[model samples]
Target: MEYTSRHTDGKRINTRSARRPCFLPGRIEGYGTKLQRDIDGKKTWNDFFFHVVAPPAMLDHGVWPDSPTGYRAANEEYCGHMMRLTRALFEHLSLGLGLEKGAMAEAFGGDELVFLQKINFYPPCPQPELTLGVAPHTDMSTLTVLVPNEVQGLQVFRDGHWYDVKHVPDALIVHIGDQIEASMNELEPN
Candidate 1:
């Protein structure tokens, strides 16, 4: 479920508080937000994962600590900006591949493309070495545009070993997913 950033008193809610659902009587919840728990009930990965569709609905979700007008406006604006940036990247790829200017965008569905943002929040762990914030896995999308954070926790597996991905301020990292790699292979002269 999408969560607002603030409490009713307007104090910013940290991920720790947000992760726990405070089910108060007479208040409805579990709307537009989803909670995924481990099947085995054992602690495996500790992270808050949220899926936001492009043109994000306010995390407010008609719940208390209703998102402030300013926050909602800013989020909308930010999503639009990111969408434009992604489209530009797609165009660049199209041209670099010697395809039509809008070929890549067209393949991705142009304006109808669904821009999905997977926001993961891994809180500070006391014994981080004992817990895994996220299990290693491959993304099933065509591409993943990762917005770097202050903490350094990303690792990539190559031929024989895993290498840590260094965090750089103000840099965006794009990882080509399986679908994109397959498409590129299909385009190669056989």
Candidate 2:
């Protein structure tokens, strides 16, 4: 999804909560830069792998406190903003496909479902080879949004060409899924 910088200085408190969706406009840029997960330059692959693996192992019969479920309630600022923006886009896409603005919104039966965000970083390899970040797959959601930080490895086959999405800042990439196709089929043909 698109993002914008929110600047806050150390004196006055900014207390206004986000009530509406925010649209970030920008095109993806650059081609071959590497995305690093080390925000403070202190994290390592060991850190990422351990956390990613440990969560599912704990999800046997009960909910985990530190997983996506916990993150949503605690990260309201990010979650709320994301909810608004996502709902808005879904509405727009619904209308574009000849449905009412809130038509798709009602179909979801309220937004109590868990939202998961995964960031995959692919650093430059010495050979840039003999490694696969993720196996080829299809997204099972209504849409999949991807933002690449640098090195390009994502590819999708369509028609006769393989489309490559290079890394770009503030780029919101959307991949439509089978459910959306079904929705489109229900709309009255114009």
Best model per TM-score: 1
Candidate 1 per-residue C-alpha lDDT over 16-48 given as tens digits, one digit per residue, 9 for 90 to 100: 235335444653332222223343343344434
lDDT of 2 by residue, 1-190 (tens): 1122233662212222242111124411111112233334332221011111112332212211234445534544654566676678778976886777777656643344334444343433333344345545687666556655665667997897878877677776777766666666555523
lDDT of each: 0.59, 0.46
Candidate No. with top lDDT: 1
Clashing pairs in 1: 1-33, 1-34, 2-33
> In candidate 1, which residue ranges exceed 4 Å CA deviation?
1-44, 55-69, 185-190
In model 1, how many backbone clashes occur?
A: 3
Off by over 4 Å in 2: 1-75, 121-128, 187-190
